[model samples]
Target chain A: MSNFNLKVPTMASMMANGETPEILFWVGCAGSYDERAQRVTQAFAKILNHVGIKYAVLGTDESCTGDPAKRAGNEFLFQMQAMQAIETLNGYKVTKIVTACPHCFNTIKNEYPQLGGNYQVIHHTQLIADLVADGKLKTKDNKVFKGKRITYHDPCYLGRGNNVYEAPRFALEALDADLVELKRCKQNGLCCGAGGAQMFKEPEKGTKDINIERMEDVKESNASIVAVGCPFCMTMLSDGVKNIDNLSHTAVLDIAELTALSNNL
Target chain B: MAIIAQILFLLAFISAVTLFYKNFKKILRNIQLGKSISRNDNKKLRWLMVLKVAFGQSKLAAKPIAALMHFFIYAGFIIINIEVLEIIIDGLLGTHRIFLFLGGFYNFLIGSFEFLALLVLFAVFVFLARRLVLKLKRFSGAEMTAWPKKDATIILLTEVVLMFAFLIMNASDHQLQKLGQAHYPIAGWFPVSQYLQVVLPTSAQALVFLERFCWWLHIMGIFAFLNYLPYSKHLHIILAFPTTWYARLNNLATLDNMATVTNEVKAMLDTSLVPPTASENATFGANDVHALHQIQLLNAYTCTECGRCTEVCPANITGKLLSPRKIMMDTRDRLVEVGQNIDRNGNDYVDGKSLLGNYISYEEIWACTSCNACVQACPINIDPLSIIIDLRRYAVMEQSQAPNSLNNMFANIENNGAPWKYAAADRLNWANNLSN
Candidate 1:
């Protein structure tokens, strides 16, 4: 079946059978090309399957979704690439798309319709929240994720573009994590320097790279770990944490990783 | 003398009609400055703008006192023409007293018209004092493109002097039937004209000859003004109403894309729709007068220098390079300049000067956030955002020169899925633990 199943914490994943699909994880560029994102998505897919929710994967047969090309003024190319993905999704009979990559979520959900590629797109945090709301998955309950000082990076696409400030926070709060929010979060969240395809091109002449500036705020929080809702944010912030020697122990963790580790920890 | 006046009047009447008819065609034809397809739109709203602003003069009335003075003065010009007609008729019939033909019917109309004439004169006086004496500090930035302070100063001065002379110099009319009841009451005991009239022996009817003499000067002054109008900043007077009437529906404060999601396009655009073999130097954006789109050209003509755009402009406030008024003025001035040259089979400009290094410099273009505030404040509806974007389109698509941030973004869009140089391989890195 198509990995197009979308599950929410409190709601059924799919309309049928009362069980929401396990994961609406969007397999994005990092999944297709970077191997690490591929490994994470694959692992998440396996975890969802083991948890007994019907699922399907959509992007395996697709091409580059042209969110990058369009923002870069190569609308001509973006059109061709976006059309291919739209056709693939149609062929897979996919109804909803989910992703941990803010860029993929934004492009596929927001920009795709600009190019006539319309589909229901969401983020993985949204699905995880839905699961918790439905009481489908059991948690550690002892609060394995509790008491450590931590901060969350509001990925621009998730926070600003889609207004998804709550889903990630809900997931983090469910783990009983002590959250230290940076100065810039929610509505006024800074860009992670990856939007509008800036990740592919060189950063323009801005005061500072938005991602590094965001990382500085996270460092200022002195949180031991930096949590993220987006894969691109995870990588940029992880790199940011690694660079500041003092803050290197402040590791970057996705909500999924924290959620899965909650039971084990 | 009567025949001479008749011939000049007929000649002037014909010239005015012909010139108005011809230039109207030229403006209608020069709608597009070059070849490019743009959104074709909003006809009903355009009519509404015309009906409300031009025909009704609704916008002018927003400031009540000025509007009243202006209405009386403008209506005065129309009614005074009847007096001119009576004069011409009398002159042709070889009589100095013209209203004798229609008996009291003709004289009554002339008397009423003369009454309007007197009001027009004072209305012009009020307009002059409002600008010069009280001096709305709005004129401090008297480079005068937006506020039209200099033009107002000139027009107001000329009107006051002409009306003053018009009152004094015309003392020879035998036709000015004395309203024995003093119906044309002088509002106040004025200095020059009222005293000078006292010295004239009673109705040898000097007001008759005085009216005729002043009438010629008034009519001739108007004719000279008409000829001078197309060359002056005051051209907006002639252009404003029609331009306002035919204006595009402007999206104020926030620019709305015409291409909303529901618009249907084929899977791929048809190649036939694209023009083949455009000129190598042909401007893709507004390079010359003809390259400007119709609404773009419309914006040039419809400006009413109320200074609202300048007043709210952040750049003007912060003392920055951006001036919305300058952009509008420079674009229009350049178009008029180049349009004249084109009429002579001489092109004084190309795309490079007007678009790339505009009078409003390129740096100023970057400073704009595509904010429609300037667009919003323009009472006559100038879309500064669209103009800025059109030039940006030329710079980015045609010239391949965009800002460094955009360059990086484009590069990342090509390589990574987004703009930040985040590892594309780490895309799923955020999903590491959602599963329980």
Candidate 2:
């Protein structure tokens, strides 16, 4: 499925050679499977590689964090899946993890502690912001998005669920783009209609779709690009944008992808 | 004459209590139908919750005007109970103003009662106006049909009549005392009642009969109110304390994990520990009211049908079918139906219809975002989301009737360890052109 080569190590291979990476790169289900989301996964991985951070994937071993199942009220399936993932992570003695998907980031960071899988989990935006703050990663003056008005869509899980708002904004701010805030931003931000496992089912018919309502906010901001943090928001907001006839030129992307593109990674 | 009056008073009191007891037993049986859950821990905290939320009316204070009006009605109802004690003593002993020994204090007490009765009457009028005249949005909805609407009006009118009876009784008694009638002691000044004296009849015989008629009407009104509580939303006056005490103590945002399921899952993780064998008839979530926990059933009863939960729900705000207020109302309706069926056909009665389709539809439950807005908005801490989740669980696990997309997702998670259609071996494919 891929052509160009990159030296990516697996946790199993690293552990076999008696080595431990500094962080575990959790390529979540969507990151691995969904085509549009895979681009974000690549963009974030490039940032880590360009910054010279040692990270390994659970390659062929990682599973879903059971977030969707738990939210859908399938407790039995959620538990069975979660326990298996926990056992694998605990076996590796991995203590730090970074992921681009907020759903994975939230479930593993918040819910896994109750399931005996405790680790220092950071979203990719948080990790990139820290790297930039530490002078480990420097952005070049590529200005592809400079002076362009870009709006940020906060994922429900990462924003309201865990209260991580500024890190993603900081990552975007580094791109020199004119960051425009939606009317309902931060704590008051509306969902992209894909939370609570809604991404896995048809929305109940309503007067207005939540994402379309949210897209109205995006359009009102007059931003050509909609920067999102979660893969689900990317899918929903992109679909929302597609349904609007006049917004053909508008782009929906993750913060990591925006960062990678702006830095010419 | 005194003995006969005492006998009649005892008989009335017993029958009133007996009718109230019969309804109370039915409610107790309905609550017992739900599965047991432990809310017995953290005694200090639960009591504090009851004091603050129920007794203190802390949540109502969010709406300042409604809060002030409710405070008047609530304080009047409670403080007026002290006067009921004196009434009971006088009725049992055939005495007049039995607590009059505390002469000046009795005057202070009676004066406060009269003043509070006026405030209560004014508050009740305001409430009636909001319901009938202003037609507040929260009070008008599909769930609030004829009975619930009329029931509210009936309670307010009853309170007004009872307060009127109390005032007229005191006014005629004051006139009798001034006339120096036998056993009519000159004890206390009731400012409002004395004001009411100008409107009383001048004849001594007419005044005595008026006083006696009002006294009987007031006591009998109280008895009717007591029995009516079990069948009306006013049951909140009695159930709110216990409901708040047993409220779920988790953060409003936190959904409780089923402890039994968690334990079984933990056992499944450790192969040496044997997980309980799956029962063929074991239903995952709630299909009927009986699958819900006892606190949930109590929550259904404690709902004042205020519609605040529905008012704040994101699903409802977005014009979706889901209304959190309706969920509680439906649960309570189904509970009453189940209780009646059991009363008629023993405990094993099969009604054939379940709560899922009969009361709440799948469309309403599925529309929820599980955002906990309803829980945060609920004044009495009723959790409609818990019931919603339980019903969703039943939809997914028991019937395997989840939406097609969800079925695909479950299959993906089962086969590929994720909710997407991709192999884990290719997970690192995204990293391939990244380091070039």
Top lDDT: which candidate number?
A: 2
DockQ of each two-chain model: 0.07, 0.34
Residue B245 of model 1: what lDDT?
54
- What total of clashing residue pairs does each candidate reach? 58, 0
Off by over 4 Å in 1: A1-265, B16-43, B57-149, B158-175, B179-206, B250-283, B345-355, B417-419, B422-436
Cα misplacement distance, residue A238 of candidate 2 (Å): 5.3
Clash list (residue pairs), candidate 2: none
- For candidate 2, give the docking quality class from DockQ: acceptable
Residue-by-residue lDDT tens digits, candidate 1, B273-345: 4334333554434434455566767677556555656654434444445567766766777766556656775
Q: Chain A TM-scores, one per candidate? A: 0.83, 0.96
Give the winner by TM-score.
2
Each model's lDDT comes to 0.58, 0.85
TM-scores of all predicted structures: 0.56, 0.82
> How does candidate 1 score on lDDT?
0.58
